[model samples]
Target: MKVTDIVDKLGLTVFSGHEGLGREVTGGYTSDLLSDVMGHAAAGSVWVTIQTHRNVTAIASLKDISAVIITCGEQPGEDTMAQSNEEGVPFLGTTLSTYELTGRLYSLIS
Candidate 1:
């Protein structure tokens, strides 16, 4: 599935990096721990996290993540948004909790 498809399917908000909406989403990783994500998230995966810090973007980019979904009605930090755009990694938002988001995403992508 494409990032855009997930956004449309889940009613997610696109906070930044619209350019990456076309990117393919092969899988997903749900975590707030930077090191865990950095070490485990696969390339082209959509990362489901509550973290909004700029470092999330750096890790997402370094790990070749397809997108970052900020859950629980949270918003990304300004620097995070900027870095997301710069790295062409879509920064998405949602009001649902991580579990809800992950369940929905899994049903769609799995």
Candidate 2:
């Protein structure tokens, strides 16, 4: 499914990177550790985390992540949003906890 599909299905807030909303989502990865995501997340996966730093966008771009979902109602910083837009990696938001969002995404994409 595309990033836009997930956004619609999960009711996610599009924080930035509108250009990437058409990107495909092959799977989902839930992690807060930067190294863990860098080492483990697959390309085309929607990453679920509470992290909102600019590094999150960098890692998302490096890993070719389809999108970043900031969980627990957290918001990405202004710089992070700008970098995400620049990277064309969709930065999303959710009011749900990480676990809940991950589970929902898994069910949708699995």
Candidate 3:
């Protein structure tokens, strides 16, 4: 499925990086640790996290992540949004907690 599909299915807010909504969703990774994500997240995967900083986008871009879903009603900073737009990595948001959102995403993609 594409990033847009997840956005539609999960009612995710498109915070930025609209250009990458067509990017394929190959898998998912849920983590708040930057190093963990960099070590384990696969390319084209959706990342579920509460992190709202620019480094999240940096890691997502470095790892070729399809999208970053900020959960628990959190919002990304302006720098993060700009980085996401510049990197073409979809930055999404949801009111759901990380656990709930990850469950839904796993069900949707798997």
Candidate 4:
């Protein structure tokens, strides 16, 4: 599913990198641990995490994720947001828990 499609389907908030919502994503991974995310998230997947640190962007960049969706109503750190914008990475946020967001995203993709 396209990133924008998932956003619309799940009513997700595009906090930053709105332009990237048009991109396509084949899968989604939900995790708060940066190292776990780095190991698990696939290249073309959206990474759903509650972590607001710059390491999230680091993981996104290193993992080649389609986007980083911050769950649990959290926002990325200022530096992370700036890095995401600079790197042209899509960064979204939601009030839902990681489990809730993952289920919704999976439903949309399925």
TM-score of model 1 vs. true structure:
0.98
Residue range 10-92, candidate 1, lDDT tens digits: 99999999989999999999999999998898999999999999999999899999999999999998888898899999999
What is the TM-score (0 to 1) of candidate 4? 0.92
Of the candidates numbered 1 and 3, which has the greater lDDT value? 3
Instruction: Give the lowest summed-lDDT range of ten residues in model 4.
Output: 14-23
Candidate 2 — worst ten consecutive residues by lDDT sum?
101-110
Q: Between candidates 2 and 4, which one is better according to lDDT?
A: 2
- Candidate lDDT (C-alpha), each: 0.94, 0.94, 0.95, 0.83
lDDT of 3 by residue, 1-110 (tens): 99999999999999999999999999999999999999999998999999999999989999999999999999999999998999999999999999999999999999
Task: Evaluate residue 44 in candidate 2 and report its C-alpha lDDT on the 0 to 100 scale.
Answer: 88
Choose 1 or 4, whichever is better by TM-score: 1
Instruction: Give the winner by lDDT: 3 or 4.
Output: 3
TM-scores for candidates 1 onward, in order: 0.98, 0.98, 0.98, 0.92
Candidate 2 local lDDT, 72-101, one digit each (tens): 999999999999989999999999999999
Segments of candidate 2 deviating more than 4 angstroms: none
For every candidate, C-alpha RMSD to the true structure in Å: 0.6, 0.5, 0.5, 1.2
Q: What is candidate 4's lDDT per residue for 1-110, written digit by digit as tens?
A: 78888788787888776667778898888877777877777898999888877777777878888898888898887898888887777899889989888988888876
Worst 10 residues of 1 by lDDT: 77-86
User: Which candidate has the top score in lDDT?
Assistant: 3
